[model samples]
Target: MLMMFWQLTIDANDPARLARFWGQVLGYQPAPPESDTTWWAHYRGRLGGRDAFDDRIFDPDGRKPPLWFQEVPESKAGKNRLHLDLYPTARDDSLPYDRRVEIVDAKVAELVELGANVRRRERGDSYYFVVMHDPEGNEFCVS
Candidate 1:
C-alpha cells in the first residue's frame, strides 16, 4: 500500500474569504470542479450557517498540494499549533542573511498590502525572518 499527500485543511470563520486571501498569497487558483458542478453550486447546498463555505485552492500548475478552508463557528483563540514558513526564495535557504532579509522585507511589504499584519521581526546570529498573521489571525513566517 502507498500513501499520498492530498490537502491541508485550515479552520476559518469564513472559509471562502480565507481561501481568496490565501489564493492571492500563494498564487494559487480555485480548485476546478470535480464533475459538472461549480464550486459554489456544490457547496451552496451544504452551507448550514457557520459551518458552510468550505473552499479549496490549488496550484495552477498542479505541482503543489491543495489547501482547504473549512468554516467553523468559533473564532481563532490563540497561536497556531503549526504555521507555514514562506521563504522568498521559495525553497532555497542558502542565501546570506542580509540578502534573505532584503527578500523577506519585500515579500512582507507585499503581504502587508494584502492584509497580513506583521507581528514582529526577528534577527538571529545568522538568520532573519518576519512573523506575520493572516487576516484571520493565523500566524506564518517569511524569510
Candidate 2:
C-alpha cells in the first residue's frame, strides 16, 4: 500500500494569519480547538479516501482543497524554485495572449490589495506567467 498525502504545508512568519488568508482565498474553515496560536485548519474534500483542498470548502455551496499553514521564523529569501500556478477555470482558451494578460492584470491588482506583491513577469511567444509573493513573501504564479 502507498501512503496518502494529508496536506499542503505553507511556511509563514505568522501561521495563524497566513492560514486565515489562505482559508479565505480557498474557502476553508477553521478547524476545531483553535486558540490564540493554532497552526492548522481543515477544508472538506475527498480524493481516494484522502481530503483534497480545492477552491472553496466553506460556503454551503462552496467546495475545494485542503490548505494548512505552519509557522516559520525567517522570511522567504532569494527565489522559490517551486511555486503554485493558478488558472481561471472559466477563462476562454481562444482569447488572444494580450487579452489574457489583461484579465490577469485585474486579478493581480485584486491580489495586491490582499497583500500579494508582483515579483517578476516573463513572457514567451506562446505563454507567460507572473511571479508573485504572498504576504509573507512566499512565491506563487498566475498563468
Q: Point to the candidate with the largest lDDT.
A: 1
Backbone N/Cα/C clashes per model = 0, 9
lDDT (10s digit) by residue, model 2, range 1-143: 74343446666678767766666555566542233211223222222344433322232222333455666678777777766776642356798988888877777787788788999988888677788888888888887
* Model 1 per-residue lDDT tens digits across residues 21-94: 88999997765433333434444355554442338777766657778898899999988998988987665667
Q: In candidate 1, which residue ranges exceed 4 Å CA deviation? A: 33-54, 91-94
Scored by TM-score, the top model is 1
Whole-model lDDT for model 1 versus the true structure? Answer: 0.79
TM-score of each: 0.79, 0.67
Please give the lDDT score at residue 117 for candidate 2. Answer: 92
Candidate 1, residue 28: how far the Cα is off, in Å = 0.8
The superposed Cα distance between candidate 1 and the true structure at residue 12, in angstroms, equals 0.5
